[model samples]
Target: MPAPIPTKVHYHKQARELELGYADGQSYRLAIEYLRVFSPSAEVRGHGKGQETLQVGKKFVGLKDITPTGRYALKLHFDDGHDSGLFSWDYLKWLIDNREANWAEYLERLEAAGASREPLGIEIRQL
Candidate 1:
């Protein structure tokens, strides 16, 4: 069976979300930050297993553009100057199915590494 592709794609800049709709009346709204942090690019996923790079300070990342790569994938251009990942239909579906678990794991990893999703600079201190 072939991987399901989104029938409709809409990027909500103000909401910083990408809404993907399918023919079966199912739709998913994925946050831009989530997509960026979990990008399939080599910079994020790395060259092999256990080589994946943990993405931090990407809470405010935004999508600069989204281009179709033939009929199988999407080339996402991020405002942070990252434009590598080729989000295939299969990968997108996987992401949708694993969204919750992946996000939770990412959070756990961040905590373990003492990393903040907040952009590189500026700190939040409570007195």
Candidate 2:
């Protein structure tokens, strides 16, 4: 079976999110920061397991543009200068399905490294 294609793809700059709507009446919102941190690029995912680089201080990263890669993937340009990842349709679906767990795991990894999502010199406001 082929991976599903999104019927709608809209980037909401004000919300800093990408909204995807499917044919089955399902929809998902992916934060720009989340996409940047979890990019499938070798720089982020690494060449092999256990070699992945931890992406920190990307809480404010923005999407500069999105370009299609043939018919199977998307090339996402990040304002932070990263644009290597090819987000395939399958990968996008996987991201949406595992978003919650992935996010939690990312936070755990950051905390373990004593890192903050906030960019350098930016203070994290505690409520």
Candidate 3:
């Protein structure tokens, strides 16, 4: 099957969101934190099946920036200092397709673990 063309793409820096438009007339707005927690990299996704890590304390995260990998993918830099995930067209589609269920699952896991998505381990010095 031939690849579908992208109609429009926008990155909102302050909002830390990526919006994509497709020729099929569907658009998606994805948060940087959502993409980070669901990264396809071994660092985030692990190397083997059933090894996915439940990323916590990342609800407030956002996208730092995006670097294009030619025309096929984007290298995402995350606010939590995670820059390993390279999102391709196919992967992005999968994420879009599964956003609702996956987000619900993440929330359920956090609740079950008695975990908070609040920030952790960062010391801020206020003068």
Strongest candidate by lDDT: 2
Q: Which ten residues in a row have the lowest lDDT in candidate 3?
A: 118-127
The TM-score obtained by model 1 is 0.92
Per-residue alpha-carbon lDDT of candidate 3 for residues 12-102, written as tens digits (9 for 90 to 100)? 7667678989978888899867887898888878889878887888866776677888787778877678888788888888888899998
lDDT of 1 by residue, 1-103 (tens): 7778899999998888999999999999999988998999999999999999999988877787899999999998988889999999998888899999999
Superposition error at 120 for model 1 (Å): 1.9
The count of residue-pair clashes in candidate 3 stands at 0
What lDDT would each prediction earn against the true structure?
A: 0.89, 0.90, 0.79
Poorest lDDT segment (10 consecutive residues) of candidate 2:
118-127
- Give the alpha carbon lDDT tens digit for every residue of 21-109 in model 2: 98999999999999999999999999999999999999877788999888888898988889999999999999999999999999999
Those runs of model 2 whose alpha carbons end farther than 4 Å from true positions after fitting are 122-127
Q: What local lDDT does model 2 show for residue 56?
A: 96
Candidate 3, overall lDDT?
0.79
TM for candidate 2 is: 0.92
lDDT of 1: 0.89
